[model samples]
Target: MEPQLLHTVTGQVATVVIRHPAKRNAMTAAMWGSLPPLLETLAADPGVRVLVLTGEGGTFCAGADISTLRGSPLEAQRLAVAAEEALAAFPGPTLAAVRGHCVGGGAQLAAACDLRFAEEGARFGVTPAKLGIVYPSSATRRLVSLVGPATAKYLLFSGELIGTERALRTGLVDEVLPAGELNGRVAEFTGILASRSSLTQAAAKEFANGRTDRDAHWEERARESGDTSEGVAAFLERRTPRFS
Candidate 1:
């Protein structure tokens, strides 16, 4: 069967699942091409507050399906890079829920997300070196931003997979939980994110990603939005703020 990128939504969270368990969810070129449009639709939906990227079976993405590379390498690279950029540019919070193998392009996609949570047995690596391919500069920069240059080099240079403990220690993963607890913990955290003020989250995300400069317009827009007033009122009244 061909590889697939599956989309499913529950409440405010949308999940993009990489599906191809026969190949450990390795993505095909077509799957890579599908991501940007899917994310754009979700981003435009007001009801969707967060996105979670994960794999279909016990494993997360193993990387790009090498078989596809034998066809058109240039096109495949373009699609893959486009997908990674789209994920990184998503307006709302994005989390990578990882398990088993997350190597090469899988690691790049996870690095693009705002946060990553992994099962205790998850393994991560950046493996272009193994194939004699240069890692994309944008991906390398994101990796460096996440784990710092030395750790990033270690993964890229060696193409050696690391366990969850090492990933967490290097700041590659935000949290690591036992396999049984991963989903529940991710749900708990994303629920909190969904309930928070979107205005605040958007501003913070832009700043943290270094995509914008500090300006008076940001504060002006926030005040005009009245999100702060509602938040304060909700706090005083002991009620959840109805943010739209």
Candidate 2:
């Protein structure tokens, strides 16, 4: 069987490719099943500073592999929930490099990431409406967290695939680059992130995640942490922080 998840480290940056391009990179249950452990491996490696998720070929993802999703509805539910939870809780920063079709569970996976960089031709949608399956609540929350409740409702209710500009207007993507520029831009962005102090990066992710839910003292406490002090000092001295 072909491996569903492909992981490799290039210096401080880690790359994960969903390797089913023969099917527009649609994820099978097994693919989703393997992601958490792979992400955990990167998370535990102190050497890894950044993670990027992409699909082989020009497509980002076409969502769930409904071909194998036959009569086992309960099994399908379990897999979907477990798959999304794994991505949602992955430690360290992650970016989804998107190009062609990004629909259904593929969109959920991207929604789990900290950032999404889409190619100009990328199309995004939450497609449970067409599939007759409910969009899991956790996935819904993540989508709403990105683009607000109304926009989330719009995508969920309509099963509509949107253009890159519409996605950007709704904050579904951080950057949209031309197809020729997508790979290089993703490398450039993650390269910058890789050079930042990991301790600061991890702490900042935690702090920002809390801020979205209206966590109090998150900012104040983070600013008081040793990592923050080191970051400020590094900036003042025009040097990189050596966060321990």
- The lDDT per prediction is 0.92, 0.83
How would you encode candidate 1's per-residue C-alpha lDDT over 1-244 as one tens digit per residue?
6688889889999989999978999989989999999999999998899999999878889999999988887778788899999999999999999999999889989999999999999999999888887888899999999999999989989999999999999999999999699899989999999999998998999899896767577798888899999999999999989875
Candidate with best TM-score: 1
Off by over 4 Å in 1: none
Q: What is the lDDT of residue 234 in candidate 1?
A: 94
lDDT of 2 by residue, 1-244 (tens): 3738888999888999988867888888788778878878888898888889898888888988887678675576678778677766666788999989999888988998899999998999998888788878888888988999999998999999999999999999999997699989988989898777665566567766664552445455565666678888999999888665
lDDT of 1 at 92: 96
* Overall local distance difference test of candidate 1: 0.92
Best by lDDT: 1
The ten-residue window of minimal lDDT in model 1 covers: 209-218
TM-score of each prediction? 0.97, 0.89
Against the true structure, candidate 2 reaches a TM-score of 0.89
Q: How many pairs of residues in model 1 come into backbone collision? A: 0
Q: List the residue pairs that clash in candidate 2.
A: none
For candidate 1, the per-residue lDDT at 183 reads: 92
Residue 121 C-alpha lDDT in model 2: 84
